[model samples]
Target chain A: MDYLTIIQILDSSLRLATPLLLTCLAGLFSERAGVVDIGLEGKLLAAAFLSGAAAAVTGSIWIGLLAGVAGSLAFSMLHGLASITFKGDQLISGVALNFLAAGLTVVIGQSWFQLGGRTPSLSGDGRFEAWNLPFADAMSKIPVIGPAYDELISGHTTLTYLALLAVPLSWWVLYRSRFGLRLRAVGENPSAVDTAGISVVKLRYAALVIAGVLCGLAGTYLASLAAGFVKDMSAGRGYIALAALIFAKWRPWYALWATLLFGLLEAIGNRYQSIALGDFVIPVQFMQALPYILTVIILAGFVGKAIPPRASGQSYVKER
Target chain B: MNKMPKWADAVLIPLISILLAFFFSGLVIWAIGKDPVVAIKTMVQGAFGSTSGISYTLYYATNFIFTGLAVAVAYHARLFNIGGEGQAMLGGLGVTLVCLAVPWPHWTLALPAAMIGGALFGAAWAFIPAWLQAKRGSHIVITTIMFNYIGAALLGYLLTKVLKVPGSMLTESARFPEGAHLPNFSEILAPFGINFSPNAPANMAFFVALLCTFLFWILIWKTRLGYEIRAYGQSETAAKYAGINPSRIVIIAMLISGGLAGLMAINNVMGEAERLIDNAVEGAGFIGIAVALMGRNHPIGILLAALLFGFLYQGGAELSFWESIPRELVVVIQALVIMFTGALDNMVRMPLEKLFVALGKNKKKEA
Candidate 1:
């Protein structure tokens, strides 16, 4: 309610929103290339577990990040092989990958750590520490603006800044680049792209790889948040990211705002058990369910029409 | 004309897929420095070694049968009803309300009433998603996924605030009346001189699951509605030309699917726990997808597949208890089965087709 309270909420919202932003952008790349990626959740979980394990074992956050990306990349490639190369059902592939990650992480984690499917608690360089921005201390001494800047803008991990940076970078890559045009074209009409001599398969694989990298960052950031890995740690955030993607209508800049809104909802839910408005009280469960309900409404076109790529969720078969 | 035999398509492909899944699961066990053979032996002994083990396996299978049939029914209409989890949760709520509302003198009367309540709630939960997909061009998959989360939240809130037993800290409903308790396997078999585990949760719901599977077969193969559903699934445009209503088929198929998913609550919630608890469905709804995939959306196949999963679950519990090999090994195997059978089918099918074609040529030469 107060300025400091508002700033504190915003601070937590940024931390929560970073993973969603990264994963949403990851999904954007995959879906924009005519590949439906419901496996985004699996990739996030896989990355989170592997990154946490790597960080704990090697005592290097960089290695953990790399391992996380590699884990996500493995799943992305598996998805590409099944849905694109084998021409199997994309949704089934995604669902299977999710189960695989959910099972494999705990199995491997338990076998290695013997801590009931959890990595050791990370400390020191194994974890990502918040970076205080330049002049943050001096800025805190000033009035309301200074405290707000220090609290809201500074004191986030490096990954948070990168996630913020990724929004513009994604917008540039998707809107301004030559590859972006081709990617959009492929998603809309892959046959036309094929006719134009661009290999649909190659473009899709490339898109999946990019998605894997972004998902890797998201997963590593998640591990950093917890300071270690826990079973089922992603905890449906990947799916929430998917909803955010739909809420944003698959646009990059819009994705940032959508994820931030979702993050704010989550922050509010964490901060309050219920919100009371005069005689009326809203339940926390309602807050938890709000994003999913909004997505359904958006999908049903009750709020705004969300039209996906024309060729999305379909495999491209070249005409003889 | 260049196709494998009907028997191969129905049986052999799935068989090979299961083998591949087991092979990979064994590899994972080995990678973790455990003996896969011993693990398998332990699982087999644990799931079927004693009457208790068998009962547990059957109990788990009963849940899977309901969910598997749910998925299979929707698949026939080409509507992937992934909202089974949410539907099942809602179904539990229905069962709870029905059992608690009337202190029934006998379960014989209570069972049918609970079934209706569960089916109605589950169908109601699924109706919005189905309607959206049928009328608004929304993707059922995404909408259903959203509904799962919403259902969980709704159930969590209800259990914590409205349904909780007064003065109890547990987030669960009060126990059902004694008369409403479905007879367990031990009680059911005692009159026939068959000794069964009294402690096992396997109950009359297993028989209900079998009955549903039979009904599912009749609905899919013997009825006009089933024919329409299959027709719609194969080609909606063609079915439309043939005067079948696509929207009607989608809605009906989803309703039946949701209803079947909801019926699973009778097994776990009413039969076993006798109370509605958080996470009563416990991933059985998702398991239904894997079961339907392996079974090729057929009733008999679903039964067999559900039993296999039931065995894996019971066995996995045993493995964890004995060898410290976390129970998640079963989940890993389930993932592999789903992957090889559903997503990576062509990886097995293409090679098999080539093999069959070559064998056909060899037969011609021999002739």
Candidate 2:
């Protein structure tokens, strides 16, 4: 109802959406090339855990960020090789990567961090601080919209900005660039690309590596910027990103809106832990289940018989 | 041009699969500064070293066999019923409810009734997604995963609020009645003075699981329904051409899968636990995926694979008893197994393909 409260709500939503934005965009690239990036969750969790651990040790957030990105990229490439080169199922590869991340992170963390799951809390300068956008704070005091801007924009870590920036960047790469054009062509019709004398395998492989790097950054944001890694910290966000990707009709801008919508619900869920509606109230569990329910509804309405890239899951055998 | 031979395919594939899984997991282990050999060895011993451990492992395996079969049954129909988690959880609830309702007669009527109740409940839960996929053109995989979340949250709410047992902060229900206890073969063994070991439960569910495996195998191979299921899995259009209604088969497959998942509750609630609720299936439902895949969706293979999983389950817990290793190492091993099983077919194909070819040629020569 109040301006300050509205600002607070937007602030929380952005903090939460950072991981979604990063992972969702990360997925956008892999999927743009027609590789279903189910492993995004694994990448996020791995990056988050490794980044947090690296930051804790080196006492530098930059090192943590790099390590996180590198880890995710490496893992994503593994997925690419398995699904793209070996002709394995993309979904299976992604699920394996997630299991690998989930299992490895916990095992290593319990052994190294010694906090069970709680990694040593990073101190001043060990974390990404909220950016102070000039003149924003002053405007935040004015009215309802002013506070909303402050909550949503003024306090985000640098990564949150990167997440927003990624939408247009992804759109440009997918729709405008030659690489994007070729990548889309390969995903749709690798044989045609091959006939055209372009190396379909190499192009798709490159696309996957890029996807890995993006996912890595997303993980770093979650681990270092949002909250440090918890057990299965990526939770089901990777899958949520997949849902977002599908609902986005595989478009970057649409993905942003879809992801934000999901983020909005999550933010609302956190805020309205238990809504006391006069006589009786629904518990948070029902509300927590709302996103998945909404996802089913969204998929039902929009994704029915939607066109996937032509060569999405097909393995190309070299012409003899 | 000629295809590769069979003998090499059979032997080479599983060998490569094992090696890759081990090497890959070893790299992971080494990266974390742990000795891969020790961790793995500890995992194996932890799961299967002693007698009591084997019994407990079998108990766990019995639960997995049913759930894994549930998954495999659906897989045979080319459906990914990830709602095994929800179905099993609901089955647990059903069994608990039945135990609450059925007055404790002898184990004869009580045990079967509990199982039937669970099977029906799980089957009903599964019907929703099956119907959606069959009639509405929805993807069963996505729908099932969604339903899993619904089941988790729904069960949490139900046990915590609407059906909260008398006094417990933990999300669990009240214990079952005294006579509602499952018929314990462990007790039978004790009375006969013919113990497999003092520690192992070695209950009737193990036999039930074996019987189910044989029955499923027969159904898959010898029955018309099973033939249709396999035919549909192979090619839906072809099956339809052959007069098989894909929609009907899809619904039946899911219903059967859910019923099997419900059987998982039979072991835990009727045999193992006095009562069960929220934490009923643990991650057996998910693990069932690994089990079904490892089993190659075959009933006999499922039995063996489930036992292997059971070993992993118990061994993980048993590792704590060992002085040097952490018990949690079992999870690492299980995770490794899943990763291997998922990627293994490619590795295993080369050798197994060779062996199959050789066997085919030998049979031809004899003919």
Evaluated with lDDT, which candidate comes out highest? 1
Q: Runs in model 1 with CA error above 4 Å? A: B365-367
Q: Model 1: per-residue lDDT, tens digit, B1-367?
A: 8479999899999999999999999999999999999999999999999999999999999999999999999999988888999999999999999999999999999999999999999988889999999999899999999999999999999999999999999999999998899999999999999999999999999999999999999999999999999999999999999999988999999999999999998999999999999999989999999999999999999999999999999999999999999998888999999999999999889999999999999999999
Worst 10 residues of 1 chain A by lDDT: A311-320
Candidate 2 stretches with Cα past 4 Å from truth are A277-280, A302-307, A318-320, B1-12, B26-45, B195-202, B320-328, B347-367
Residue B348 in candidate 2, Cα distance off native in Å:
4.4
The numbered model that scores best in DockQ is 1
Evaluate residue B30 in candidate 1 and report its C-alpha lDDT on the 0 to 100 scale: 99
Tell how far residue A320 is off in model 1, in angstroms: 2.4
